[model samples]
Structures are given as C-alpha cells and as structure tokens.
Target chain A: MWDKRSDMIVHEQDPFNAEPTPQVLAESDITPVDAFYSRNHGPIPAITADDWRLDVSGRVERPHVFNLDEIRQRFTTHAVTATLQCAGNRRAGLIDVRPIPGEDPWGSGAVSTAEWRGARLADILDAVGAEDDPDLHVAFTGPDVSEVATPPQPYGSSIDIAKARSGEVLLAWGMNCQPLPRIHGGPVRIVVPGYIGARSVKWVTAITVIDAPTDNYFQASAYRILAPDADPGAAGPGDGISLSTLPLNCDVLTHSDGDRVPAGPVTVGGYAQPGNGRRIERVDVSTDGGTTWNQAELDLPYGPWAWCRWTHTLCARPGPLSLVIRAFDDTATTQPETPAAVWNPKGYLNNSWPRMTLHVT
Target chain B: MWDKRSDMIVHEQDPFNAEPTPQVLAESDITPVDAFYSRNHGPIPAITADDWRLDVSGRVERPHVFNLDEIRQRFTTHAVTATLQCAGNRRAGLIDVRPIPGEDPWGSGAVSTAEWRGARLADILDAVGAEDDPDLHVAFTGPDVSEVATPPQPYGSSIDIAKARSGEVLLAWGMNCQPLPRIHGGPVRIVVPGYIGARSVKWVTAITVIDAPTDNYFQASAYRILAPDADPGAAGPGDGISLSTLPLNCDVLTHSDGDRVPAGPVTVGGYAQPGNGRRIERVDVSTDGGTTWNQAELDLPYGPWAWCRWTHTLCARPGPLSLVIRAFDDTATTQPETPAAVWNPKGYLNNSWPRMTLHVT
Candidate 1:
C-alpha cells in the first residue's frame, strides 16, 4: 500500500490490487496518483530510474539495452491524457449473475485517467529499426514474477505492431508531471492508450518485437473471453478471444446499489469510456429497466482517449428504484443489455448496462 | 439501369440507385461488379479516363492536378479487399420502427466487398506535401451535381486527415481486377475502406485538405444522426453527429421477413461488418425474441476490412417462428436490441437486431 490511498476498496492484499471509491474517481478530471486504481498480477518490484533498463530485441535490426536516462534524452518527450480500465473493471456485475469463484469482484471504480509523459513508442521503434510489418507484435515483459501465472513466469503482454507504431503508445517514466509510482508502472511502462490496462504492461524490463502475440500466460491464456461453460483450467493457449481494447462502458457514480435516499428528484452522474480510439458520442439512462431511455448531457473535458463524464436529472417516487446506464461510441455501438449476454468463465469485460438498485424513502 | 443488372432492387430511377438480391450477394466472396450496390444522389456522370483530372489543393505546400494515367503510373499500386457499406444499409429496420420520410428503405444489400486497386491516398498526400495536422480534414468532390442540395451542388464528403494518411484510403481505377465501372466511380474514385460508403466519394474530381470538415450538404447536413425530435428541414450544417465509419451490424441473408420454411433443421446465414478497424468476433442467433441465444460460426475469408459471413442452424416446430440476429465485435460491443433505440430522421445506421419472421410449414 505504498502508493495506494487508505480509501481504496482493497480486493487483494499480497499482490496489492485495489480500486478507488466512486467519489474519488469522480472528484477530478485526472485521478490523483494515490487514488488511481492499482491492478497487478504480482508483487510490486522496486527499481530506481538509474538501475532500470529496457531491453529491445526480437524482429529488430539490432538488439539494444537502454537505461532510463538514455530513453529520456534520446527521444522527444510527449504526453497523452488517457484513461486505462482494468479488463475486470466491472466484474461485480457478472458475479451477481453467477458465481465466478477465485476472482476479484471489482466495482465500477477500476478505471482512472492520468496525464502520462514519456517517449513515443513509435519513435523508439524507429530508432531500434523495428520491422514495419503489421503482422508483428510488440511484447513487453516486466520483472515482477506472478504466482498466478501458470509455471509462475513474469507478467507479460503484447500489442500489435500497428498499434505500437500508431504514435500513441508510450514508454513512460512520469505520471501527472510526477515520477511514476511503484504501485502503478514504475520507472518505465508501456502506456497503450485506448487498450485494456493489461496491455499497458507495468514495471517494464523488456520490449520484444515478435511475429505473433506473446505466449505469456497473461496474454495467451488469461484476459480472454471464453464460453461461460468452458473450464478455464483446461483451456489451452489461444483458446478464446484475447481481449485488447476496452469495450464501450459506462458506470453510475452518484449512487451506489442499495443506497437509501429521500424520494424526490435524483441526479445521476457517471463516466463513459470507449475502446479503440472511438469517442463517446452519447450516454443514456433508463430508470425502468431499459424499456425507455433518456439521453444524458455528455462532457469530454479530457482528451479523446479519456472518459466522457455524463449526468442526468430525473424525478423519483418512493419505492425500490432501479437505474440502468449505457453508452454509445462514435460508431454508435452500444453495450450488451444483460451480463448473461456477455458473461465468460474469466469474469472479464462486464460491459452490460450497470443496473443499480436503490431504496428510496 | 445502365450499370445495374436486371436482378437489382432498384430504389430510385433518376439517380440510378439499387442493390443486388441476397442470393447474388452471397454467391461469391468478392461481389461481382454488376451485383454490387449503387447509392447515388445524382445522375451518374460519363467521363472517359482521358477527360478526367483530379485537382489536389488546400493546406498543402503546393496545389497539383493529375490525370488518370499520371496517377496510375506515379504511385505504387495497392489493392485492398474492402467492404463498402452505405450509412443507410439497413434503413428498412428503422422504417419499421417509425416512418422516416424521404429516405430509401434499403434492405441489407447496400454493402458489398470487392478488390479495390489504386494508388494509395497517403502517397498522393505525401506527394502534394500535405500538412500533417490531425485536426484537419481531407475532402473529396465529384462531378455529378445533385438537385437534392439546397442550391444544387456536386456530391461531396470527407474523411479525417489521419484516416487519409493511414494508407488505406485509395484512388481507385480498378475494382475486382477489372477497369472500374462507370456507375461505381469509373475513371477514378476514392475507396475509403472500413468507412461509410459515402466517404468513398464516387467520380472524385477534387481533393482538398482543410482545417475542418467540408460544409458540403452531404458531409455537414446529410448523413448525420439527429435527435428523434429534430427536423432535418430546419437543421443547419453541423447539426448532429456526422457519421463516418460503419457501425457493428449483421443481416440475415438466407431468409427474408415472412418466409415459409420446413419444420426442422433450418440453416440461417448472414454477414456481419464492424466499424473503425474492429473485427466481428461473435454473432448470435435467437429463435425466440432474444430471451435465449446461440452462437453462430463466423468466417472472414475476405480480408480484415471485409464482412464476416456467419451461419447458425436451429430446429423449429410447426408454426410461426421469429429469428433475431445480433453481432459482437472484437471489443465485445453489441448492437442495440431495437431499431427504436437508434432511430434518426435520416434513417441511417439501423444496427439493431434484425428480426425475421417465418412460417414453418
């Protein structure tokens, strides 16, 4: 809990995974480093900027190792305001549908926005003479070894070469104009904006340009959407759809489930985030189980890759109240209506309309 | 009628707009030129390759004009097997929800895949020393004047500078390895793969780089998603979300509405297309009204930009049966349940679950 705030809703203690509360997430456009969600598969590794090194190899003209200073001095610094959401950001919704044992039930707070500053990964690739093949992938491996991974290997993941060279991916050493925190990616991490936070590997130590996606346990086996009945343990590599980008998702922040309030006017507020560089065009709230939907006012004060804050006001009567919310990106793609529609064995990407039931007095 | 086949479902006669039958569309992996859909706002212009010239201007170091031969010889030829979908491909579904006046009730035939070969638009932009501004837009204009415009202007539309430079947009002189047909932008047309077909301006005669989206009637006023209550007549330019990419949509091609079928073991087939560089990951078929769902087999024999053909077999009892189809892209974003949820005045992008009713004999 070195970098985590006391108010975080702790889901794990050994690997130190936790998410900020709803109020903390909605308080500012950029979440404070301490209040940002921390999702880690292994214990946080301790490394100083001077000691850390990034090894660049695989499908490159020449393999090279660069220290933090070399990376900072070689490439021009760039900053991108991006929102990163955990693949299991809203697993609590899926848990309510059925029992997903041995998984963290993350609420809606597992997403946060920060201004990440670093050298563009494209520039680094260009310097390393990385092959321009779109079929290749840029894989990253951190030093922290995860006991959760089969055979207990280091946490690793990858992104397609096209995304790596899109000029948005970053090798970051700074967050919110401050030195990167250990709980988050420390000295340098790959900040893959618009993709799942898992792809943005933290505590980076290696960058390999490979022909296929890294066969790391995290990339090949976990973070996939398998059939609901498929046993995850028996599943082999490349079994299910390996998730990359965050799906179109929104969450209500003004009220929590089972909260009691005086019956009258209720203003609901939330944040909407889209995947794959798409912008949130509209968000809708349904007070009566999605039979009818009312559009909410959308505000994207942050950059394109950040989340859009939405709010709507409606009158409520005294009784059990149900509020459901969904979002549409620029492509007009909406979320699945029910968790049962998108439920998987791993309990990942529960982007269904989050139904929050509250007791109104 | 000049470029359309006898089997085409003609929606308009003056502008010569039509779509091929489902059987024609499903016959081949690359849709035949005669079977491809044609959506025109004005009479097709007749311009031989010798008479055609493309003028490139606006935010560039120097304006340049090139004839068809020069364009073909100057840049490296690139062929993209892409699917072009009209924004109004599935407008009939929206028409079922509510009457959208002055719009063609297009069935799912407004989309077709072809091998488009031409010079890369990025090469053209690079040759003209185009300003690399992400905020700027690349506009294209054709020679055919439209009476539908406020004061009668040529058909025009635009894509973002980033997309134009992404190396996918093409100035095509060939379709399916044959000389481009007169009706489908014969001499030279812009083939913007993965975007709404309107952006692939047919009969392109001019290309301009600008700071903002073109104020052309089609780009600014038409092809947008307006509020259900907003009046198109009173709406000005930049009124609503101007559509660019295709939405995640699927269509049932094997059976039309109100069809008669056998009592058991019926195979339903269709196509699914995703927008903004995403791939169709799953397609679900529901025999009932979406209460239960079964997955369909997905095949993308065509390249990434082409439609994914899907099929599912289900048993039926003797009586009336209803089949609903929905698609999920790689991001797990599914279509809205009902057309009413996405109904607009222009009847564009009706990506709802297409419901087909059949009587089991």
Candidate 2:
C-alpha cells in the first residue's frame, strides 16, 4: 500500500523499512519528507487526527486526556529543525568486523532531517503536574503492535524526566510544515531530540511520569548492548549496556562501495552527525589509509540536532583507494577507525568510520 | 606519621586522607597548600629532586630518561591555575540513599585549586615519537605502592594520546611557585588538567606510549563505578567504566551542614566546578526547596580547569532552613538535586547538590 516512491531500497515489506539512495540524499541540504528513510517496527496505525487522544497519567498532578486540537490550543507551538537517526543506522558496517548483528543490515540511509512543529514536551508537561511533584522518567506508549501477536501490543520507552523537561523534547503533530504522516509516526508522536530514535516513540497515545526507567521490552531488554558473548536476539531483561543517546558518526554517501569511477578529479562527500547535542568540530578525509589527511569542508549553519554535510575534492589514481573518514565531536571524542573497534555483542552505537572503495577506470 | 593537618575530617591513617573544614575553605579565594585536601591511596613516596628520573618509553621513535633539571631546562615552563578533585571526594553523601560505598567516608573537602608550573605534556610527548609512529594511550606510572602490594606495585593509569597532546596536561616540577612537594606528586609528576585527580598520576616516574589501556590495578579495576552490589573494594578488570573527567558540582564552603548560625542578613557562598573543560555558566541558590532560585554572583577570570567561587546574600528568618545550591556548566549539564539521584556503588562522581542547614539564633 506504500506506493508514493519506488526508488528507495526496501529492506522489509510489512512494516516498511527503507532508505533513499546516496545520490538522492546529496541533492539537497534538507531531505524532503518523501525521500526520507522510514524505519517502522510495526504496521502503521491509521488513526485520524480527530480520533487521536493523548492520555498522560501516573504520579502527575493532573491526569488528563488531550485531543490534537486541544493540545495545540493549550500549549504554544515551537518549531525545531533536527535529525532523527536510527540506532542501527549503519548496522551493516559491523559485519565486516564480526558476525552479523541482530537487526536488518542497515547501510548509511537510515537517517533523515526535518523541521518539527509542535508543543514543547516540557510545556505540555508543565500544564500537567511536574511542578506539584517531580518525577524521574517520562514513559511514552504508542498504539503499534507486534507483528506476530494475536492481540496488539503497545510500543513504549522512557527517558529521564529531566531530559523530557529540557524544552528540546516535543509532542510533535507537524513535520516539514505538513501534517505528520502515518508512515513516520503520524497523527501524534513524541520527538525526543538528541536521543536515539527509539526513545522518540511514534503514534504516541500515553505519557506516564514514573520514578524509575521503563519496564517495556523495547527499552529494558531489547535496546541494550549485552556482553560481547551474549546472544542479542534472545536477550533477557536488565543486562544494561544501555543505548540511549547516539554517538558521533559520519558516512561517505556519494560513492557506492567498490564502484568504478573515472580516474580524474572527483568530489567525495557525505554527512556527519554528532551525538549528545555536540557540534561537529572537524572531519578529516584520507585516500591513502590516514597516513596523510585533508580537512573536509563542513556545510554549516545547520541546526544543533541536524547533521553537518561535508565534502572534499581529490584526484583519484588508477588503483584501489583506501579511503577513511573520521569525525571529532565538540566533546573531544573521535570516531573510531572501524566498526570492530567499538563492536559490542548487540552491535549498537555503530558510529565507526564509514569507508568506500572505488576502482578507477 | 600524619601530622600536617588536624582540623579537617581525616579518613585514612597512613596516606592521610583529609579534607579542609568549610570555614577554612572559605577563608580565602585561593586555598593554601597546607589547608588543601589530601587524597592518597598509599604512603607518600619521598623522592628528592636529584634522585627523580622521568622515563619515556614504549612504541617510540625516541626514548630518553630526563632528570628534573634537564626537564626544566629542555621545555618551556608555563603555569596554570587549576582545581583537582578526587573521584570519591564526597563519598559520605552516597550512604543517605543506598548502602555504604566501599571507599572512605569522605566529606566535601577533597577539592583544591592551585597554580602549577610545569613543562607541557604535549611538547614532551611530541619530542618522544608520536610523530614517527602512532599510539592510542599514554600510560603514567607512579612510584608509590599500596599497603598490601607485595613487591612495591606502582600506581599506573592511561589516557588517550589526544588528551596527552591537548597541551593542558603538564609534567610539573613546581606548584604555587614552589618546588613540588612529596605530599603532592614530586619532584616530577604529571598534571592532567581537566581529568580526575587519579589520572594526574602523582609521583609519576614513567610515561609510556601504548596501543591499549594500562594493565595496572588502579587503571583496569578500581576507578570505575560497578553495579550496586559489586565489590568496589576488590573490583575486577573489564567492567568498562573509567572516570576520566569530573562532573559539574557545587559545594557550600561558608557554612557546614546542620551548623548553627545567627539568623537574618546572612550571606551564603560556595565554589562551583565544571567537568571536561567546560566553564561554569551559572550558580543557582535556593533557600526554599527550589520554589524560587536566585542567581549567585560568580568570581570570574578563572582557568577552565579551575573552580569558580560564587556567593549570595540571603535573609534567613527562624527555624530550619532548607538551602539547595546547584551549578550549571557551559555544556548545559547541571548538578543533580541530591546524592540519591545519582547513587553509584563506588561513589565516584558525587556531583549531587551540596546542602547546608543553619539553625539561626
């Protein structure tokens, strides 16, 4: 039924997992909503904007239900241009270092940037009862179900309440100046800026303030990177090598791996994103395995949560290219050389150096 | 053996772990060397300036042993006014929430600021082989041994080479315009600015460039916060947490907790320190459980690694005063409300709000 665009790579069919090609991504500064990557864990719940009701309960002063129009009328709306990246954005890169990860073989296409307009989560929560009594975590529950479950199960996760009230988190109802789409957690969803995409629950209907972390399987069990020898696919509760905020990463998107390019002056470029609201300090590009390097020009003035696009021009000889690119965030943490350097058993936080091999003709 | 200071709370018997009293700490802008806190894991090793030799080895293009005189002669001498805090500085605060931590019952007296004069660590490492070959870590070995160490095991730790080359780290031979003393690291020791005091590696004898982390007990085992039930006293290797930098924190230096003072027109003051090279942005003080917070005036013109002193005037009326002070760093992270909020097993990062109660007469 998802028939708007057919040019993207479809990794899954039922729940719709796909990403646009690198050529399409480099064509513009802000990725258009249609060409943006879709990483859905379940089938889209076709709930209308009028029918959706947001229920906030648990330890709050005011346990109330809010419709879409009421939420908009009650709180002042704000817009934020940010990037939302899947935790498994470059999961495919880990296979070269070790065995395949538990998730889909994700390439570099599982990230997208957009302008979100909605009420600040802190503002909406202020209307409720955070002032009367402080809580520890804010849990979000979406009305999506497991693929094999006979009865529908909600997808939920929690973030620190302090983070929720930080004004960056949003109860988003608009994306890219349009109504939120079902494929992208539409009608209503929560946008937790600067954290992993999993924490940004889609199709959100319930928000509960609790004294502890979420007990949902997606949060307490599935999202963590267990011990290196543990089986991630069958992970139990409470191992907790937690994967909450993303790490600094960059991807060389202009050229496909092992593709043949003409031996002459060529421009190689990609996108670099930093985690924990850190700015991208610098990105270095090397063609001969980092022996010598040149700084890539960063396309700046982007939002703090959006990715910085970097491009560098270099001449390619008629031999194999040992291209390597690394990014340093404002926090002084550098991107690892390869996926193996940061490999966990679950292979989460895959912010390693993304390389490309181009054979010159 | 331990006879230097007596007024402060002493935690250890041999190495003389002690912290200055709040009144003593608030006496002056810069803490006096004698009034400064001492945090030692072993007996202080007395090494004269003539006997001390600093060795540079491991995976280098050049390896040399330089005496104290040669080190001062070879490199340019610079001075930095910085603050150093032990990881378990406020260990006593943890017991209010959970079980008692495995370390000393330290109060809030383990931080002090000083002007240190030394040769830059970056300039020294640049001379001895990072240019010829690449390395990941720079391991620092101290001459002091633990009480139970059979063969005089030296305390050792490693830091990222990028951090070593950051230029703020120093191979110090002097402190506060005087020769480095045995109580501190001397005649030559590393001053790793912006990192924890543990990584500074007191009484440093050897600096080795390596491909991985240090194999010493302090580096591989003791410094991290384990699970709540884990044995911090006898920690094992590979727990994966290494506390390199301090957290944003503030401590009231003028008044001790539960100390009785005259009521009305009282001025409350404290010191604020930010972690990881971030400067203190603002200090917030509230005498009424944060219902209303007043911004405190901060003393400026301080180094990035040093603490910023803040003072505030408040009129205290009668009985029990619930005073809460918190600090915000430039990176936007703030101090937690209480120690219970961030209770770790080893009591490593005690950036919780340091409170003071005065029974006004």
Candidate 3:
C-alpha cells in the first residue's frame, strides 16, 4: 500500500471528508491515496478482498457474481491518470455568500489526481450480456450512507447507458500502483472520469440497467441545485438542476492567504482542471482586481481527466493586495470574475476566478 | 417586549444569528422590528434600561458615564430608515466554491431594514468632548460578545475618526416607536448607516479614540477581508482589507425558487440596495442568459440606508429557465457576472447577478 499522508484538511470526521493540503497535492502529478481527498457519504465497509463480490444482475441476459480474482481474469486492465473532485469541493465558497444552516464548509483540498487501473465498465456490461434499451441508465449501489441526508440512506448514483458505452467508466481496484485503500473504495470502485466524484460510486457492489436514474437519496434529492429556501423533502428526482459534468476550476497551492512577501518578484503556482474532457487553454493572473492580467506558463496535461499545473512570477507592490487567478478551458469557457456572479443555492459548482488577498510588506 | 416573527432564518443558538425571510423583508417599505434579523455575537447580558450606563472611556476631555435617559436628554432625536446587513451575508455562495472547513454558509437573508431613531454619534462625542489627531480611529466596544471567537471576546469595531464625525453615525435607542428590544441592543446601539452591520456595534458600552483601529478580536481579525485561506489568528488590525462601505446588492424576493406557475406572463419584483450612498441607476432582467435584458421599474428610496424595491413582468415559455437580474449603481459599477470572480475566504459582500432557475411546468 502506498503510504497515505495524514496532513491534509479534515472538514468532517464522520463519512470521512478530507482534502489534501495544496502543497502536497501540487508537488506531484499523481496524488497518493493518503493525500487524495476522500468524499465519503457513509462509513467505509470492512469488506475483505476475498469476500468482496460484484453482483451484475439487473436487465442482463447472463447475470454473474464476479469476485476480485474473477474480475481481473475476465477483463483486461487499463490505466489512466484522472483527477477526482467532490461536487461540493469548492462549496465553501458558495456558503461564504450565504450561510447554509447544516452543511460542511469545504476547502480547496477536496480534489486529487491519481493513476487508476481498472477494468472498463463497458467490458463488464458486455460480458454480462446487457439487454437495456437506449436512452436508459446504469445504476450503481454501495453500502455507504451519507449522514447528510435527512433519514440517512444508503449510497447510490447513476450514469447514462450511452456514457457506459463510452469506454471511459471503469471498475477500478488500483490507485497509484497500489491496491485501492479501504478509504478509497478498495477491493473495487467505479471510476467515472470527467464527472463529479459522486457519480463514481465507491465500494460499488451492484449495477442495474434501468429506464431512468437511481431513486437513491443522493441521486434523487441531494445533488440537484435547490432554492436557498427550498425544502429537501418537497423535491424529487429530475425536479431541479442536476449536476453532471465538473466545472472549470483552478487552485493556487504555492501561496496561502495573508502571506507576507518582499515588495519585489515572487513566483505563484497552482493546478488547473477543466470539465468533461476539455483541456485547459490558458491561465491569467491579475494583481489589480482584474483590471490587468499576465499569462502564466502552463504544463501540458498528462491525461484528459488529470489537472494541468501552471506557474508565474510577478513584481509585488508594498500594500494590501489580492492576487487573482482565472483559467479558460478548451471549450472557450472562462472562470467567472466574481463568486457573487454565479451565486447559487446548495453551494454547488463554483469555478469563479479564485482570489487570495495578502500583504506585500 | 416586541413580538419577533417566527418565519425568519435562525443560524445559531445561544448567541443568536438570524435573518429575515426574503419575502417578508421585501413586503413593506419599512421592515417591522419583529421581522428584523438579530445577529448576536455573545450571550445577551442581563441589564435594565434604568441601570444601564454607557462608559465614555478613552482619550476624552469630558469623560461622562451617562444613563439611558440622561444620554437621551442631552441630544436631539432623529429617525432614518436604514438596512443593516451582516458582512457575511451571502457567504453560502462562497462556501459553495470550496468548503471553508470551519465557517458558516450564510444565506442572503442575513440582512434587515428598520427605522432607527436615536441621537447622533457626533452629538454624544460633542458632549463627551474630543481629543483626536489625524489618521486616527474611533473604536466602539459593546457588551455583546461574538461567539465565533474561541474565548468569546466582546464585540468591538472601529471607523475612521472622520467617519465618526460624519453626523450620519447614530447612537440609536428606539426602533419603530418602541425602545430597542433586548435582542437588538435594547438600551442603545450605534447605527453606522451604509456601512457593514459589523461597524454598527450593538449594546455599545465604550468608545476609544486611537491612532489605529481597535485591537479587539472582532475589530482586528473578524471583519477584514483576508485571503480565503488566511489564518484568523495571524492577522492584526490594518493587516488586511478593511470594509467600510457596503457593496451594491440586489435580491429577488417576490417569486420564490421552485415556484410552480402556468407558462405565461408573470411579474417579478424585489429590492435593490446600492453601495455606500449610491442609488440604483438601473435594474436589468434577463430570461435567456442575459442575451436580451429588459429594464424594470424602480421606486425612489426613502432614505440612504433603506432598500429601493423594483418590479418587472415578463412572459415565460414552458421549460427549465434561469431568471437573471443585475443592478448598476450610480457610479457605473454593474454587478459582476459571477461570484467566483470576487470570491474571498471570508465570504463577504457578494453583489453578483442573481439567477433563479425554475421550471414552468
């Protein structure tokens, strides 16, 4: 097992919400299991590797219960470096606008990059003889239950069957060349690259081909963007804005808030990630409240799902200042200039220009 | 005791943090005292109006500890309708960006309006006699303690000495013909109209004239705009950006989110508040991602501190849509298109184009 670091942020203890310190995360392209932020909804089930079995049953011509060894033997393994982020990763930014009574105020540590090795989900569906019609979905269920829910229900989510045929979704068992840690859904977890971490169900135990999305608590009520005053009990599936793709986001790891620097040159750096499979096109840095900006040097992405880190150096003036950073994705989308511009309820998916104000002493 | 309404949002217990219901807040020109939000930092100190005395302590030629009636008799009473909004209002939008780990996700409801009646702060300072140098501040300390602090420090804030002399600063004792409620600094409170609510210290007990801002926890650390990741413990007074003027903000209160309505013409209305003393020059409403905007009708403001409400009617087609509204202040500063653009760690002053997503089913 790769040694997992214990120094990152721990937003909540139960369900184990943790984010890697930006310093540690920015040091390497591949995030170690320990450094990876864990966005868990329920307690980690202690399923032994040998005892764990993935049951593929619903709407299949041939249902098969595949164990760890059987799963590896049945399909070829593929590896990809992907960045996983909690949909609520930057959620604290939204809550900063308006306080949401009962919720976690997450920090920038909720994302991590890792090399994942797994069997393609399409291969498993093909072997199971999928009989689902078009325009349907594949639902995955796990034993985890998000304590954030009103009644505290088991964890579940779904993706379009068309997405299943895309050959990107995987049933992963290895992370960064090590067996996935139990905190990261070791034994087996579904990896839905480019989508939010919620869609990538961890500790996945079953898959069902259905005509619609899963009716699980998270899928039905949790992820959607509800009104700030909207009651969770009144809404149902497909009733509000459902989050699917990740938003364009960037974080400055090299610098922290309230940091003091000499009134001269200093280097600033961070990682940039884009939605779906879009690559980051350019990054701009501004010290004068977006009045002017300088382009930063960007590294090519290792994979479509992984983040591209960037760096820049600028002369500082001795005064209180805000260092602003914004990134544009390949889709020609740029980060919003202000967090208040894209203010939303449930505090989901904020990719505005990130600003860190400090003093040049 | 004045009757406090039950419909407003209550953010914390013990030291209460509450805000009015948006709909109720926008209902009348002058908000009822019961509907006014109460933002308390510490336990309500037990004191009677007859026993309470304001201690005029630091750097005063004529130091006078005056009781409530004595203080009232020494100055002339004036009334003004002003809106007091917490600096952390709309913080939920910032928390939505990334979790701030340990903080509140404040909603837009963290603001309220009232007709505050009181003697001018200048009048009190005149009676106390003053000794001040240039580049100095007038610090106000209250019996209230902000629970956000670890040791529960008393609430304190400071404004420029020149600002203290602005005549707009009021040492208020009455609200809507009733003596200030105990929950709202009953005996007396400082109403710095147009500034963030933090500067309007409630339950005022002392005033200190100093060469710099107050060194108290709330003054030196809490209200300033520090970097999102900045440690609250490391900052001192004047180390970060200090907020004096309130930012321009608008809210849609008439139509709630997730509202079910027929696919036809509908009226939308709400309030628009300008930053500082600027008036709302215009309000633009967009039904289609701001491709086309229709100006809404605006009402003249009653006072500089009170909100100016507006209304607009438009036809809607049956579909999922976002009704976007943005306001421009007299200074030509239009609302930012996104919150991430202006995102800060503390989640203060989000004046973004508010968008409400709804379904016309």
DockQ, each predicted model: 0.37, 0.02, 0.06
What is model 2's DockQ versus the real complex?
A: 0.02
Query: Model 3 TM-score?
Result: 0.53
The DockQ ranking, best first, is 1, 3, 2
Q: In candidate 1 chain A, what residue range of length 10 has the lowest lDDT sum?
A: A332-341
Judged by lDDT relative to the true structure, which candidate is superior, 1 or 3? Answer: 1
TM-score result, candidate 2? 0.55
Model 1 — TM-score against the truth?
0.90
Considering every candidate listed, which one attains the maximal lDDT?
Answer: 1
What is the TM-score, restricted to chain A, for candidate 2?
Answer: 0.95
Give the C-alpha miss distance for residue A109 in model 3, angstroms. Answer: 0.7
**CAPRI grade, predicted model 2:** incorrect
Off by over 4 Å in 2: A131-135, A148-152, B1-361
lDDT of 3 by residue, A1-361 (tens): 2345768687777767778777787688787777888887778787878988888878889998889998899899998788888877777777777665556777777888888899999999999999858877899999777676657777989988977867778899998999988888888999998887889898899988888887887887777755334555577665545666676788888877788888888888998987775677777788887755677899888878888999999888899878889876542345666655445456666676788987899
Better of 1 and 2 by TM-score: 1
